[model samples]
Target: MPFVIAVLLAADAVSLMAAGDRAFAARDFRAALFAYQDLTREDPGSASVWVRLGETYARMGHDLEAGESFSRALRLNGKNASAKEGLAASRERLAILSPPPKPVVDEAGARERYTAAVRMINERNYRDALNALDEALRKRPGYAVALVARGSARMGLLDYDAAAADYSAARGSDPSLASPLFGLAEAYRALGQPAKAAQLYRAYAESPATDVQPALKEYALRNAQSLGSQ
Candidate 1:
């Protein structure tokens, strides 16, 4: 009975996907959006459906919504090229609306993109935030905050290798910033470099995180003592 139900659901998904494709090809994006929305609810694990939904939102000039969908798709399957492209495009589209980079300390374009990335992160749309931070780093290669945020997003995506690299760069660039210390420690632990992680956790525990996130300082203090003991 379960096997028959699965087959029936799959067939329904196929039929709905065909309808969405037709609507998309005809440029009836509203219809396509509706179809894809239904499909996403019916087949929530389908990365392709989420990607199609994102594409429809993009065509409608709803970059934020598009980004959310693309991020969800990537969460389900990070290797989905269409979802990756859609996420990047969504970030780029929003970045274009802001003023151009100023060539000074606060490059306006980079700041805009970085802010967009933060907004996405706050929404738990880590993939979109990662894409935006990548764009921000391209604009300002030395943006430590963007690097740190990218590390956090990569950590969310379970890309520990990239996360470690980004956190290390950010930590090297600005040793005073406390947030990256915790994040770097986290990445190192994930990568099986417990010694490196423990050191950074100690640093994080000693930093002035009480001014911003006292909870982080306490968490770091625990990790600093626990990683070595374990």
Candidate 2:
């Protein structure tokens, strides 16, 4: 029975490793991270698994986690060249004082598209608004305001999943931007994720008055209260 259990565990590790590799090759960092994390839990002593986790974290720009994972792999197997390389790379990234500069973009054209999207949204033409926002994002990737507007357009079109994704991207691009919180909360609510919705609503409500309008804050608080009851 012990031998059989060992074989099953080995099979599970093999399956997870394959899944992680496939996800990593496809640039699906989130899925790769999940599989690698599960591998860490199941086989903590596997230096290979730790190295793979480190690679996934590095690809996702999580330098701190990558550094830690690489260190763990090196500790488990001091001769692991991959772990050493990853550790060195992560350390270099960590040592950088400021982030690299962004690529030059046509800001004027992007702003024009964003303005068109806002106008379309005001007219309730969500489809057109989405198209304009897409053009704006294509011109200027990581445009936080355009992302928020796109999220709103997606919400209007009942595409809650896409809306949530856009809102999440906007939040990542500009953590201090307050609009994504309310938009993301509404998207979560529409997607039936009441807990996440409530959490975001509470966050929106608690934002400084200078950041969030009084009426929006009041509305967010009311929604938070309503969702918390569920």
Which window of 10 residues has the lowest lDDT sum in candidate 2? 207-216
Q: Mind sharing the TM-score for model 2?
A: 0.55
Off by over 4 Å in 1: 1-106, 208-212
Question: How well does each candidate superpose onto the true structure, as a TM-score?
Answer: 0.51, 0.55
Best by TM-score: 2
RMSD of 1: 22.6
TM-score of 1: 0.51
lDDT of 1 at 101: 70
| lDDT score for residue 80 of model 1 | 95
lDDT values of the candidates?
A: 0.90, 0.94
Residue-level lDDT tens digits of model 2 in 38-141: 99988999999999999999999999999999999999999999999999999998889468887778799899999999999999999999999999998899
